[model samples]
Target: MRGPVRWVLWDVKDTLLKVRRSVGEQYCSEASRLGLELPPSQVEAAFKQAYRRQSKLYPNYGTAQGLGGHRWWVAVVKDTFSQCGVKDGATLEKLSYNLYHNFKNAENWEVFPDSERTLRSCTDMGLKLGVVSNFDNRLEGILRACGLLSHFSFLVTSEGAKVAKPDAAIFHQALQRCGDPASSVAHVGDHYVNDYLTARSLGLLGLLLDREGSTLHLDDVPARHRLSSLDELPALLQKRAEGG
Candidate 1:
């Protein structure tokens, strides 16, 4: 039997926050500022290709091979423009640098409508909150800027922990900060495998935030383990606490 939840671990991207604009739109806007004009659709497609290639080549920001997050992201950004026909090395480097820092700003990200309210509700229930994200060091500034930083007691990033989600080690790092047994912690994220299955496997209550019902077809996920929005969170936690 699982104990009452004492901590709520959150996943950052697409869970509590998301980019204000699509990758292609942001990249094109930045490129325009650099005096380069590119179609947003074209840039978006190229970005998808570049991102997949980069992720495949340098998983987890290439930490294992010493690339680190900064270098890894710079490569992805540079490749994205390169694939869109920009070949000037200096221009690529400049654009990559600008884009990297641009994302750190709060203007580039927007909090989910229900994020703050739900976080506050969790706090009111006497639950501690922390972040367990696959993001890099830039996450702290992003969270702080978005006004959600104060809600969390700690943050554990894959870059900081050297282990990304679906790997379990990252969750363990968050657990250490939580100072609670796995049975008394719950993790919420948008990814099914990384957030739900993995957390459940580790004995934590895994709640999948499927806002779009994208996972509705997955029979393995019970209704209790899935949420359509953050607005549903506090009630769910209360139900769990009451053994409903």
Candidate 2:
């Protein structure tokens, strides 16, 4: 189901933008720049493994239970390089930290043409916009780099939310920050269960931003709107806003 879309929350990585070339390419280049002699595949694999473990712990972060994703990412970066024989010194740590930290905001990252066009159209149409993403890096930096920051008045990261996606708390924070109820907000993102189901479960209108999945989800979010591209959003919101 669709409605007036008082607010639209977006996902950052695959939905709004993609990395330039590939992780292998950047890992190799960045590693060489830091004077590391490790192979690209090996360094990239370790880095990825570390990131996964770190991002999984956001829910327990400020409480007595868990460490948040950023610490997880830093540890992963540190260990990955240390295992490759790089010592845990300031230079090595800074190289790993800032290289991965700056990856999203770097000039070479690519935003889908349709994404830029749609975001512009939506903002022009006067719809409130914000971002709710599970990220290690500050999302605002990436949004600013993409020239899309002005479109958003609210942007919440896992750091602020204190939990990652699939946890309704983060989405709730985005909604609260945007000054809307879940019923009037829409969440558009790529992942099936993580983004769509989580939003739908909270009674927010959830749309899966994937070209495939014309079929319904086995769990919740089944029958939710499916958008092949963000290009369709302006029209979808237009219809809802006018009660057409």
Candidate 3:
């Protein structure tokens, strides 16, 4: 473990927590209450579409922080409703933001089944842990609420780092906090280019958790491991450590 990976850095959304339901669920429900009459499924679909639109916004806006981070999600909800034939923009936006505020107070975030067990095992193995995420400042509190704050000794967020994935500085900041080497620390994520390849570029181990193959940039990098499931992680890491 002498590489940039003496510590383990995790991504939040899509890595540990699955966000099975929309993060905007409560707000979307409220939108329906305001005569939007939008089906839950339609709202969910619109949310996903709007979420992906942030990729375009970031480059043009030079926004290093995640575009869909709270404020962006507010606009996303507004735009989504507008596109889906909702007439009252101002009221819906307010409702959306109000719902998002409730999320800020929420502690029980849904997580993948293997998430807690995996992090616990990593801690038990004596590895230092941290998070490098394209997240809002609320990430720490959210993880803390989910009973996960104790696992990570540190976290570097886009809000704190002022840059998102593919930026080596963010990862470096995480390593600096953990007092570890990037070469020894394996970065695990579901994203191909943003997380795994970025780790590879920094001489750290890159582990890809490609459940749905949503990693469009997958072919662009030579990842150290391609994991189709989180269940395979512990064994694979043990093998890598033992030179298997």
Candidate of highest lDDT: 1
lDDT of 3 by residue, 168-206 (tens): 888888877866566778888877778887988887787
Per-model TM against the reference: 0.97, 0.84, 0.79
Which residue pairs clash within candidate 1? Answer: none
Candidate number with the higher TM-score (2 or 3): 2
Please list all clashing residue pairs in model 2, or write none if there are none. none
Q: Write the per-residue lDDT of candidate 1 for residues 134-217, one digit (tens) a residue.
A: 998899999999999999999999888887989989998899899999999999999999999999999999999999999999
lDDT of candidate model 2 versus the reference: 0.74
Q: With candidate 2 superimposed using the best TM-score fit, by how many Å does residue 151's alpha carbon deviate from the native? A: 0.8
After TM-score superposition, the amount by which residue 57's alpha carbon in candidate 3 deviates from its true location, in angstroms, is: 3.5
> Candidate 2 on 1-244: residue-level lDDT in tens?
5446788888888888878766656666777776766777777777776556654643333222555555655676776676666785985678667765766565757888798889889889887888888774456777788887788878887766767788888888888797878888888999887788898899887888875655454454444377888898888778778886
lDDT for predicted candidate 1 compared with the true structure = 0.93
The predictions' CA RMSDs to the true structure, in order, are 1.0, 3.1, 3.8
Off by over 4 Å in 2: 1-3, 55-71, 88-91, 212-224
Stretches of model 3 off by over 4 angstroms after superposition: 1-5, 22-27, 33-36, 41-55, 58-70, 105-109, 212-224
Candidate 1 stretches greater than 4 Å from native: none
Write the candidate numbers in order of decreasing TM-score: 1, 2, 3
